[model samples]
Target: MTEKDFIPKRYSESMEHGSVSWEAPSNIALVKYWGKKEHQIPANPSVSFTLKNCRTITRLDFSKKENQSDFDFEIYFEGNKKEDFKPKIKTFFERIVQYVPFLKEYKFEIHSENTFPHSSGIASSASGMSALALCVMSLEKKLNPEMREGFFRKKASFLARLGSGSACRSIEGDLVVWGKHQETRGSSDLFGIKYPDEVHENFKNYQDTILLVDKGTKEVSSSVGHNLMHNHPFAEARFAQAHENLAKLKPVFAEGDLEKFIEIVENEALTLHSMMMSSRPYFILMKPNTLEIINKIWSFRKRTELPVCFTLDAGANVHVLYPEKDKVKVLEFIKNELVAYCENGHYICDSVGDGALKLK
Candidate 1:
């Protein structure tokens, strides 16, 4: 899609002061986006489920500033000043300054908080950046009252991508697809598109219970990992495989094929880590307990014939996914068998959620 796809009108009136807030959810890719290019574009398409409960809420209070070219903002996280986050937010503001011209006229107070641990395997950047994007756009639409809803969301997603690639997907709820594809209409390398309505009802409300194996910060950052993929031997083949898997998984979503879903999701999870290990200066993000949890999940699945499956992000924590109908048994299994593997028996129970919410 081009700029014409979403048109925001130029407004003559400028708001002297405004405040906007939004809550955006994190997402886990079923078909992973492990590589990228310039401007945060994905090397291959990815599909993910929007997670509930695990989210970030961000509020921006803006007021007029005289002759300011750079960002003037103070940010707080969970009632504490986050001086460390200022640099990233500054970079984000610089990248998006052109698109949002009125930003120069404003000084901002940005307050943000997360529902889950920051670096413990969850995509904190995804939820954080998207929430901030939503708040910014919400304030923008106040200035330009003519901004349409589609334009508003697409613009927010586009801006979010500049901060974090997965953050674009967090702008929409349920299932979101990012990256260009021959079969997916309106899919873009610039922003995420919500999965089509062709999805089967059975896939709705899917459960994702995260087992926090280690709460410590990751050894290698996601940015460094993406950089490693640049010279990865399997880069070409891996990208191709992602396209193929995405094509295959669409039908599975529409048909509600749990068996195929398990296969595709599990493969995507492992493929993510495999690429990391294959990098020239490789690293391992998974802990010993990660494998142990996987084995137990598989063994339990085999014994009881349940549909439970596991997927991982860039860290050691395992997200155990299954359908809501099997919640009782799954929770029981987690309590009895999986809690031992998690750090301090810590885990989060979450499910599919409605995307970002604009606060009144």
Candidate 2:
């Protein structure tokens, strides 16, 4: 056999792919996925873009280990034991097994890592699960050649949800919005989305700028905060606001309207933060530095009459979106003022980039 033929192959009742590797990025939701319906699916249909610059690299290899009672999953980020992440990995495995029982027949050795800092509220779940999804989907595509274009991606996203609530959005491309068919709206399979501009054209160069405000996301897990929202008295009206924002932003997104985009995105992010404030225990991600930066950006824009606007994710990180031309001045502002408070505070400037890709 030639060198190519020397590659070992397994043909068994269970999926037998030699190895699968991929990298996908974490997404910061603009219009958030707040509530869940069946299967913990989101109540409003949401959408987002898969970012390119910051992503998790994952590799899955299987060699038919002996103690395959059902499934075994191992995960790591930044080369350290991710003990807290095991349950979700197992849960995701169980979900996959529910659909394809044979995959459980073989033991899986899985390794995952994020390019960005861990536990820093970077939405690692989004990209981490996404990379895993692609890893699994690659094996699926190899084992089951008949799989269709979007078949594996969506299914893997649904499976990724079992790993983390925000993770489901990571499996697709840029412009990933998380929302699903509202039961009230008479739809099932209602969760994260990369909705194909149903009524208008999709923006080609959608972009964002991320400033790592702090590395202290351990303060509140999105999961805990999410549960708080569910029981809050204003949850219903708050969710309704998310829905309304979705409607307002979707059309502009399709049209690639930047002004409307800034308006709606800022409002949606603020709306999410507002909920965090009113939640019984009352959580807040914005610090003095956070607002100072925000005020400065708005002040600069208002003074110079520039158009850039800022938005915040669940954590203290801030995302500023503007035309690519503004990158120089924007970067200078961050380098000078934004990092003054915290020694570790840094920023990565990224624009809307392409979706996930295979490594092996």
Candidate 3:
């Protein structure tokens, strides 16, 4: 999609200096999306739990600037200037400038800080882009008082999707689904929608302990990995499997079937990496420690009769998921066994969150 497609009918008004801050959480995909289509649309539908604690808090300070044809903005990460992050933010503004025309008339000082460290195998894009989207949409609402709250969030999700596909899912809480599926209602390829509340409470308040297997950057970026799927021998079959699993998972979630939940979640995680390995130019994103953690998690679950499972993103870290009821046992296991495999024994304990927050 282009900027021309997002322009509102009215952009004749301008506002003075003001700042908006928002905190948006990262998400862990239970049904992984490995490929995409045009406009950053996912090739397959995916579901994820919105994570708390591991989030990005962003503040946008806007000031009236002299006549300028383009957006004038500076970005800071953790109080430090981030020249590297400017290109993506610049491109994102260019794509959505039509919707917020006053962006060109203002100079912005953006300060963003993540709760978790960068390149730690967490989905920073999901939190960062969603937080920015919330800030921009908050500014737009101030300019146009008639904008409804629901529309503001939907638009933010749409804008976030343009910046990063999975970022759209970060706009909602508890659980979210992106990409249209024949059986899912309200699902769209443009943006994500929160999962229905009909889901069992057992799935709510799920704990996720992110074991930092490797704190370094991913060997192959998610973008490059998605591109590789174009020539992957199993791409089509993988997409089909995702659809089938999502369908099965919906009922499993409503039925509160922990066994099925563990089955689907773990399978999805492994399938994601398997696709990467089977690609035309094969690569492995998982480290030896990642496998060790997974194996240990399996053994622990079998031995203790606890309902726990592991999922990985497009990186080497392990996300250990379990119900809130098992928190004590899970934490004890993580501290005793999993910590040994983690990088310097670092891990972020997080859980399902209530979506993004607008800071006062």
Candidate 4:
């Protein structure tokens, strides 16, 4: 749907005070979207696996105020007031106010927390922003009780994208696609949509074991990385490759071709890091242990003939993906061989999930 389609009609109803809460999961992109256009539009199409265990839970409480001149809000994280986070939330409210329209009408208290460590290569913004977006949409739904389920989800994702581009995908589950691609029906740059075609059973409940190679703040944030793509020497070709990779995955997904899936996913991960290294002011996000873990994963897969493979975000951590049937063997291998590469021997075991949950 177009951006205009997301703007709601003028509302006649009003609410004095209320509260809403939601939990939204993080996702791992198989076909990475490394660059973006203005308004959080992705430069190329990408698909991801929505994760179950790593997520953010957010609660929003709203009360009517006498003055409706400016947006009013207080933010808290894990039961503590977070002044540093206000700017991002303020910016988000500003971006979404045009569509939600009720931001200026009430004072809001937003309490949020993440199940996993923040800024630890886990795409916390995707889950955090999506959870907050779902809470805001709940308030909107209260104002217009007639809003359909489909529209609610669509607009929630639409608003989430304004907060973080990949956040659009966190609103749905299992497999979600963001950015417009010719091969993906009903895909849009405005938000993410579930893969419309049949997905092979092989992909269901797919496992993603994230190895925490480093938990510190990234040397280069995702925003800076995305901006680097504007004049990047290989930006055009990289964008084209994402589209081509996404297209290639369709048949592989449908046919349960794990070998082809591994090829595309691993290549996409390396390609992402390659772009970072090739930028004008080049930087590498991967740590030494990150490479070690990857090499170990490759060796183990080769020796065991398992469907295990690794993907990297824009950080030092590694996301090890494998089918559910191989979970027993994969987890054992990870603990015995790969855990040494992680920070403090920390890692998260997660699998595919079915979208966000409304807590209240």
Candidate 5:
């Protein structure tokens, strides 16, 4: 909980680099990632592709203090200094130090920022902590060469999971799964991939236009929802459903069978919402605009058999996945129908993006 809580250090060292940074992209589930068997860890080993257009860039630098005995953490939203979020953050820094040990004596200052909404969904935590994890790991590498990738990967997830559940998934891309702690220990079967995890192969022909319907953020955080799973009887059911769906949907996506993929994705989307509805404090993030888009999409499916489909992630935003070949029609559909039924007159279209990395 604090620097004093850490059980002393096994190794200690200090070094400096100009600074390290990473731009980690957010990912949406074409097949949906929902529920969890063990809190922040994945329920059924869900996979996702990194978005190309949006991401969060993070940096870290250290300075030796002549007076202070402990490390401190700081965060900035846009350009304003924000230290109120430090308690949980400092706790995480302690975890990082305790696990790595060699960094225990040194002081650290974390500089993190998100490009999009401060916390208004759209997978900000996904890219935000992914960037953070990599930056921290980079610092560790520069200071200690004995640590391996496997050591940092697990340690990074452990640190990021405390900050946000989705943050664990942000550590990897193309296709990433927050491996169950039990399975990750030499279990090669944590996840499956039917299609090659390539940017162009899975996404170039596809377009997922996000319809930003303001739901004013959820009353419950995923962390709170995750804690609820301890008592939520239906938690196991949600986990099972996500597993079945992911296994079946992977092949559908690989074949580039749009119709099959949409069906699977939409069903998985509904299942994710079902978990939220069934939670103890029971809340639904869907809006009237959400259902209207769903209806129109279904009707279009019936009339034209297009591959367009809808997916929601704990918020009112409707991410409509369609073919880039249908861009004009897609844009027209958003402008015209949304004016008639959506929650807002404004929206942004984002394509699938690259995974987390240092910028050029």
Candidate 6:
């Protein structure tokens, strides 16, 4: 759908004060989205598995405001006031205010927390921004009771994209696709959509065990990394490669070709780092332990002939992806061989999930 389709008409109803809460899951991109354009449009089409256990829950309480000249909101993370986080939220509000115009009319209290540790290489922005966007959409739904369920979700994802690019994928399903691609029907750069094509049963309940190689914050943020791609020598080739890999994945996902899936996924992960490392002012986010864990996973997969593979976000941590049927053997290998590389031996076991949930 076009951007104009998401703009809402004048509301039929209004509330003086109310509260809304939602829990949104984190996602691991199989075909990663590394760069973007203005309005948070992605540089390439990407697909991801929505994660079950790593998530964020946000509750928004709003009251009618007497002074409505500016956006009014206070944000708390894990029950503690986080003044530093306000600017990001304010920027998000400003970006989406045109779409959800009631922002200035209400003073908001946003309480948010994550299931995974903050700064643990998890995409807290994906889950956190998505949860907050869902909460805001809930308020809009209340304001316009005539809004349809489908429209609500689409608009929520659109708003979430403004907060964080990857967040749009956290709004829906076991599999989600963001950005426009000829091969992926219904995909849009404006928002993420539940992958509409047939997915083989072999992928059902796929597992993702995250190994925390480093819990500290990164030296460079994802925004900076994406910006570097603007002048990157390989930027054009990488973007084209992502589309090619996504095309290759369609039949693989349909046929349940584990080997091809592994090839595409692992390549995408490494290529993401390659782009970062090759940039003019290059930097590395992967720690030494990250390589150690990857080698171990490769050895284990070679020895066991299992479908286990690894993917990385823009940080030192590694996400070990494998089919659900191999969970027992994979977890055993992870605990015994890979966990040693994790900081404090910390890891989280999670599986594919069906998107965000609204809480009463």
Report the lDDT tens digits of candidate 3 across residue range 70-145.
Answer: 8888999998999999999998888777677777988999999999887676769999999999999988888888
Stretch of 10 with least lDDT, candidate 1: 3-12
Q: For candidate 1, write residues 80-194 as lDDT tens digits.
A: 9999999999999888877776777899999999998775557699999999989888878887887789989999999999999999999998999999987888888989989
Residue 89's lDDT in candidate 6: 96
Candidates in order: C-alpha RMSD to true structure: 1.4, 6.5, 1.8, 0.9, 4.7, 0.8
- How many angstroms is residue 281 displaced in model 1 relative to the true structure, after the best TM-score fit? 0.5
Can you list the residue pairs that collide in candidate 1?
none
For model 6, residues 179-265, the per-residue Cα lDDT tens digits are 999989898999999998889998999999999999988999999998999888999999999999989999998999999999999
The TM-scores, one per candidate, come to 0.97, 0.86, 0.96, 0.99, 0.82, 0.99
Better of 1 and 2 by TM-score: 1
Q: lDDT (CA) for every model shown?
A: 0.90, 0.68, 0.90, 0.94, 0.63, 0.93
Superposed by TM-score, candidate 3 places the C-alpha of residue 248 at a distance from the truth, in angstroms, of 0.7
Model 5 misplaced stretches (Cα beyond 4 Å): 1-14, 31-33, 37-39, 66-69, 102-104, 119-123, 145-158, 180-205, 339-344
Clashing pairs in 3: none
Q: Between candidates 2 and 6, which one is better according to lDDT? A: 6
lDDT tens readout by residue for model 4, 1-360: 687887888876789998999999999999999989999999999999999999999999999999999988999999999999999999999999889988999999999999987756576999999999999999998889989999999999999999999999999998999988999999999989999987999999999999999988899999999999999999999999999999999999999999999999999999999999999899999999999999999999899999999999999999999999999999999999999989999999999999999994
The runs of at least 3 residues in candidate 4 whose Cα sits more than 4 Å from the true structure, single-residue gaps closed, are 119-121
After superposition, the stretches of candidate 3 with alpha carbons farther than 4 Å from their true spots are: 1-6, 11-13
Tens digit per residue, CA lDDT, model 5, 217-285 = 676776666666667778777667666665665566556667777777788778777777887888787
TM-score of 4: 0.99
